[model samples]
Target: MIPQPTPAAPPRPARILIVDDSAVMRALLRSVVSSDSRLEVAGTASDGASALRVIDSVRPDLILLDVEMPVMDGLSTLRQIRARPTRIPVIMCSSLTQRGAQVTIEALASGASDYVAKPTGQPSREAAVQALAQDLVPKILALTALGSPSHGSARGHASAFPLSSPAAPPRTPVTANLAFSTPPQQPPSGFAPAAVLIGVSTGGPAALDLLLPGLPAAFPLPILIVQHMPELFTKHLAERLDSRCPLRVHEAAEGEPVRPGHIYIAKGDWHMEVSAHSAMPDHHSSSAPVLRLTRQAPENHCRPSVDVLFRTAAAVYSGRLLGVILTGMGHDGLAGSRILRQHGGVLLAQDEPTSAVWGMPGAVAQAGLANRILPLNAIASEILRLSARSQREAPDLRETDPREAGASGIGWVTP
Candidate 1:
């Protein structure tokens, strides 16, 4: 008689190390981690130092680090963790407060993989738990790839999540076949862009640190960015970037006109779009396009979504826009990139090797939406080269110089 075949054993759950100063928070985090079948808490520590002590023994697949701690803070501990030979992903658990946001941003720049805001204004424990589950769980599954069927060993885990954005929107999931169906298309030739729009998430802060500093002060087009982060965090991020960038960086303000040589970051919790300023008294002419921040429902599970910005910019700049999709967890910018392309705008995607999570940019690349898939280091030079080309090759499109428009309070002609 033939024997029945043995069934394969289920995959082991990804182990998590929780490090926070408060016992209550630790317990709450433990509950959250345990709620998922794919995740389990390996150990808990009261501070960064304590975490380091048990880290080797526990051999956690990922670490949930707290920014502020009693003995050794998250930043100091992060430096140590990064210096280690083996790489373990760390997600900073930060409060929604300004200081927490600041430190979290710094931690992200200093090698912390990602972060989640601690629930502060929740009405009840259950509500807080639900919120944590929604935000933190997805991040954990995305980072460790424990939720993915393709995930193999601990060292070579694959992502379970798709492309997406910050206070941006819930990501719209596309099957692998549909996402990569289209072959790479050639970029439109003899095209010039008047403004540059960027979408990034997950590994954005650090990626921006490398990309933004490279753009010279004389950058010809107005630059707008959507980064998945909360409110106070966006402000601090803008400040941090402003200090390092030659071009002025701002957490986009409401009603401010978009200008060349300036970088505007979508404010956290607000969807930033462009609107033509009110028409002149006669009503035939209108002023330059100004930023409009809204509380519209988040697209792709994010508020300051890349799609919103890209779609609106397409209308304002028409064929003269440049959209760049950077490293992010989900495909938040994919739909917007398509709209931009439909409007004859150019698109650039960050290549996989340089991305922390290739979800967002990868989606664009797979969809055959990107005109150029480039590494992070090369993007700046490309932008410069394209801007230079706009000046030399597209004289008709440059009917009014951005400087003259700024001085005269004029706007784009929608050419």
Candidate 2:
């Protein structure tokens, strides 16, 4: 009898480098990464310094880093890695504690790719292990397999696609592909806009890093952003964007008048709302909308939720608002975009492949809410085209030259 033929061996799993101070953390991370057949832990390091030392040998495609460590912190390690020529994506594991959240934000600004809040052992905490698998695994899978054709489908592992945000059982299946097959296209016309409101989460930091820098220095209208992050991280992101982009970027402050030629990032841990003053009673009042910060209960399990900001902006700006839903893991901006549509506003979404996770944008795209869906590279230029038509015919409002707005330099207002 002829011998039976054997099946070919499976492809090598994506190698992962685990870096953390705690042995338990490293072990847990390893288990999570290895849970799938397509991923395996390549090496372990107790600190950033040690991780750096072994990077050459391990030659990992991805790194799971702990934010705090005795010998070398995550941020310092990230900085050293960024200085090198090789480009490897890093995911940081940070605790929900104030300090942990803040430091994690700094790491993102310092060039870390993404982050996940460390699950706590307390009974009151969410399931740490489950959250890690659901959140971290998908990110690793997506980032490592970025341009691979086999992405976005169930590939024998949970990390093969972007997972749902906030750590829960997925409400829907992942997309089949994240790419745009056609060339970048222009959006519809006839609508004029006063301001830009963007709602993003999960993959926001890196997406914004790519987008904000691409806009022209003379880009009109202030851009209001709601990125689901801890307080310190939001502030750091604004600072980082300010340095990189032509637009003056800063954290949204209470009573600050939203203006043209600037970008206002919603402060972390606070729900950002747009409240019209109709010309405030104070002498400092302007016709522009006033920034309102509140400690309202979290929506969609987040304080500075995309829903909160988008809803209020829809109400305040009405048909004059321009809302864009970028990459995120949840449907936070869906309802808000619906409101924008109700008021005759324009909304755009980032296409799938460019998004780290297509949840937010997909939500709008699937619902038929987005007026136009463009690739990540195309969205920046579309913003200019969509808004410029109205801007050209726009009537000038009250303004005093700060000298900064005249140029592409940074602008600041004291609270």
Candidate 3:
């Protein structure tokens, strides 16, 4: 009989430290974390101070930190955590209220890896647990790099959410003919980008805090952004960014004119698209694009999906568009980026090292869709450089049929 080879030991589950002032909340989070075999609860802390005291001993792969806690609050603790040499990923567990959203944004800007709104208004404890699991578990798996065969059930739960597990299969294109050939490594000569569309999630608030402010108020192109978030949070995010940036930033509204020097963030729960509005003969000769918002079904398990926005922007702007995919979880922007690239649009992806989770942008980068992959800090300068190019210096590439340009029609779908 042939000797059997020794079985290799399985990888250890990622350890998590739960920190919340409420014992009940801590217990709930522990239950959620424990339900996934790929994850283990290393310890629990009542507040930020306690968490800081035990962090070294617990050696958790990630932390689920509550925004409002007794003693040292989440932000204070987060700042201290950043001061430390060892960096552990911290996921802010916040309430769905306005104050919660405000504080969560601050924590994110301060260096929290990501955030999940605590389940509220669910009819039952089980329902609440399910909601938390769907939101929190995938974040754990993504930020901790814990995707494995042992996490089967956990990954399945995550599939019900917007962020897909790493073990999941590559997403199928919405249309069969949408298959891409050799995507251009660089835009064709004379590619003059008239508009900049950005898709970001996961670590977006902080990334945006760093990015939007970098663009001077005089930045020429209109910027449309899709940041995966719920309703109230998006509003608060807009308010926060607007106060800090030189350029005007606001939550996008229906029928607003898409104008240069202003930034529009897609409203939470509403898909934002652009449409050409024929100018009144008395007012102007050419049509101008206006923002259009819809209550479309969620794509990639997300409302206000990046693909939805990208697809429409590509159609409205055609070859004159520039699509930027930033730090995010899952592949929300991949399909859109593919379609945008097909339409002679330029693409930029945030590099992995600077990303909090790298799922969305990584997909674009891996698919050969990105014309450039730059660090978080470099994206603003590149955008400025691209937007400043003379439109007349190079003839617009929009005249070429996309199919003839080596791509096919975009089949937009919500799934």
Candidate 4:
């Protein structure tokens, strides 16, 4: 009889340490991690002091840290852990509040690997649990694969990536039509959208640094963005972008109207949407469009999920909408893009060469979702061209046709 090879030995389980003040939270995490046979709950701690002691004793492969603790919070714990030169990967668990969001960003900056939003009271337990398992677990696995030695170096290198190069600011204007042959389909009622929606993550800050400043202050379109960032970091990002760009930029308020010449960022812990307002008979004052913000359950494991914003825009704006998806780590925006495409809305994605992580954009591109995939530098110019095209094609407008406008006295300006 032929000898049979013995079954391969089972792989070692990844040891994990759970740190949280709440007994319930600790139990929940333990249960989840334990459910995965590849993961083992090595130890548990209530605060930073206990966590630090456990870290030295157990030397776990991963740590799930809660941002709010009685004695020492997640941020303080992260700092302490990093200072000791231990290389264990940490995933931060945060509440879906503005303050919580800010703290999560700080944790990332300070050296925590990744974060997941702790469910707010409003969302059901099932939704909250799903968000944590889907989003946080994947991030933890990805960060751990980077290994301890390379983690610090990767962070430093990523930070140094240029926001925008000053020398190439005024290169040849790359129009959208020239880059892609197929023209955007004419809207059903010839109604052009008044605003643009953008969803970006991972390399977003750097990409925005290049794109935002190129836009003119008088550019007559409102822009709503759902960038994957911690709450506090987003405020800093807005301030930074506002200073550099000519347009007004601010975090979205609960019920603020979406208007031209302004940018609204989705606030941490709340999903932001644009809705139509009933037109008053008077028509004298500015139209009061309603902007909705909700503490609803996260979609695709993100509180201010790109999918939520994109789907809402697809429904409200329909054929008038322009949806742009940028570099990110997962397939959060794919479903929403399908909605946009079905409604005759335009879709754009960042090219893979310029992406920090190509997972998000790649999914869209591979599935034939994006109408145009352009380099990071060319995105702003494409937006300008598309907006201009929409305006020129508007049925009610008596403006000169684009072909005639190009041949005639009106000079095409790139902003």
Error of 4 at 139 (Å): 2.1
Query: In model 4, where do residues sit more than 4 Å from their true spots?
Result: 1-137, 143-160, 163-193, 230-233, 278-285, 390-415
Q: Give the TM-score of candidate 3.
A: 0.84
What is the alpha-carbon lDDT of model 3 when measured against the actual structure? 0.78
* Candidate 4 lDDT tens digits, 1-415: 9999999988677778999999888887877676666778999999988999878788787789999888999999988876654455677888767677667666665556556666556366566566566555555444443322211111211221232233212333223323332443433334356568888765566667777887765455778999877566678667667777767888887657676667788876688777665333443344545467888898876778888888887767777778888766677888988888888887888765455445566567666778777777777877777777554544243223222233333233432
Worst ten-residue run, lDDT, model 2? 152-161
Per-model TM-score versus the true fold: 0.84, 0.72, 0.84, 0.57
What is the per-residue lDDT of model 1 for residues 169-188, given as tens digits with 9 covering 90 to 100? 33332322344556656565
RMSD per candidate (Å) reads: 7.3, 8.0, 10.1, 10.1
- Which candidate number maximizes TM-score? 1
- Model 1 off-target regions past 4 Å? 1-7, 148-179, 278-286, 393-415
The segments of candidate 2 whose C-alpha lies over 4 angstroms from its true place after superposition are: 1-16, 27-43, 49-62, 68-89, 95-103, 109-111, 118-188, 278-284, 398-415
Candidate with the larger TM-score of 1 and 4: 1
Q: Cα deviation in Å at residue 371, candidate 2?
A: 2.5
lDDT of each: 0.79, 0.74, 0.78, 0.67
Relative to the true structure, candidate 1 reaches a TM of 0.84
Ranked by TM-score, top first: 1, 3, 2, 4
